[model samples]
Target: MIGGKGEQKTLRLVARHADIWHSFVRPHELPHKLDVIERWAEREQRDTSGLVISNELGHRGEDHADDLYDAGVRLFTLAFHGPDWDYDLVRRWLRWRDAKNA
Candidate 1:
């Protein structure tokens, strides 16, 4: 996987060598970042149709998943911290994902 926060060099590398690209970029910036990746892929003569876009949904998983999906993210990873964490968020996201898949 190629991981970066919308860096041009990183995107270029992704275009050249990756099947997956992961990042934590905000929803508002996702389109532009994708465009950059497309441009880089074009330059590298790579077909980006097989590229899988992934987003690390830090603390904003519940808030941004839908928007990120709309913006082209196909895979998601949630952030969990501490020993007292709750699984409710995971259940909710799972439900949402199920509904989307359905």
Candidate 2:
């Protein structure tokens, strides 16, 4: 389910009903979002051991990537937007990320 705004409650409901929680995340707010997830897990007495946390990183920014990783974000979808989509830029960023991870 794609949603925002009322995400805390929605996440709880989704956690209970769905197998995965795919959600969007703003770079600066990722920590708080993870905190909410941890809190929700504790409150619900739910084991969130294998929950998949995915986010779209539309541009290449080191801090954004680092913050997302620190917040336990595992999956990322990179996006490029413009009249002419830039595959080169996306490829460069992917290489950089892979190098960093390596």
Candidate 3:
């Protein structure tokens, strides 16, 4: 779900058939997109509580983890490119995950 039309179409199927929805929307857009999913789920008589929301995190997303988490994103896929990958983000997120679980 990337473009507006594609996202909308995907969301409809997500509501009816998906147990997980992975979104590329930014942190600010998460709530609204989630609301749309909820509405579609309601239209289909589906409960979204069991629906897992996943988001991808690049360097730009490091600062917004809390915001996304608060918005109900439970799964995060971290992206690292290039031949030399920096593990700092990985360490940071691991620490954050530990603290959250603790």
Candidate 4:
């Protein structure tokens, strides 16, 4: 999974090099970006449905989590800054994840 993003070249790279992308894009932007990626994938005869999606929890937390999930994100990275961490958020997501995976 490519856990990052960049400019136009980023999409080109994602099209040519990635099978899964962990975009730095905000939740609202994911669909469009995914569409862009899908178009590229299409040009290469790649099946868009086979691509996996991911995001960093720091982007928006659970507020956008479910939507991201619904939009095809299967992986999520929780970025913790330092000493303090939000295990509660993790737990909640874990619950949702486990159930989803189940």
TM-score, per-candidate, Cα-based: 0.87, 0.67, 0.80, 0.75
As for candidate 2, its clashing pairs are: none
Q: Among these predicted structures, which one has the highest lDDT?
A: 1
- Compared with the true structure, what per-residue lDDT tens digits does model 4 show for residues 38-100? 777777776667777877766475658877887778887886665787777777778877987
Highest TM-score model number? 1
What TM-score does candidate 1 reach?
Answer: 0.87
Stronger candidate by lDDT (1 vs 4): 1
**What value of lDDT does candidate 3 attain over all alpha carbons?**
0.76
Q: Count the backbone clashes (under 3 Å) in each candidate.
A: 0, 0, 0, 0
lDDT of each: 0.84, 0.67, 0.76, 0.74
By descending lDDT, how would the candidates be arranged? 1, 3, 4, 2
lDDT by residue (tens digit), candidate 2, 1-102: 433424558767655554555567666776676567667777888877777677767654767777876677677777668899788888876786797689
lDDT (10s digit) by residue, model 1, range 11-100? 899889999989668889988888888899999999988999999766675557888888888899877776977788778778988987
Structure candidate 1, residue pairs in collision: none
Residue 71 displacement in candidate 3 (angstroms):
1.2
lDDT of 3 by residue, 23-64 (tens): 877778977887888888889999878888888777655458
- Those runs of model 2 whose alpha carbons end farther than 4 Å from true positions after fitting are 1-5, 18-20, 42-45, 81-83
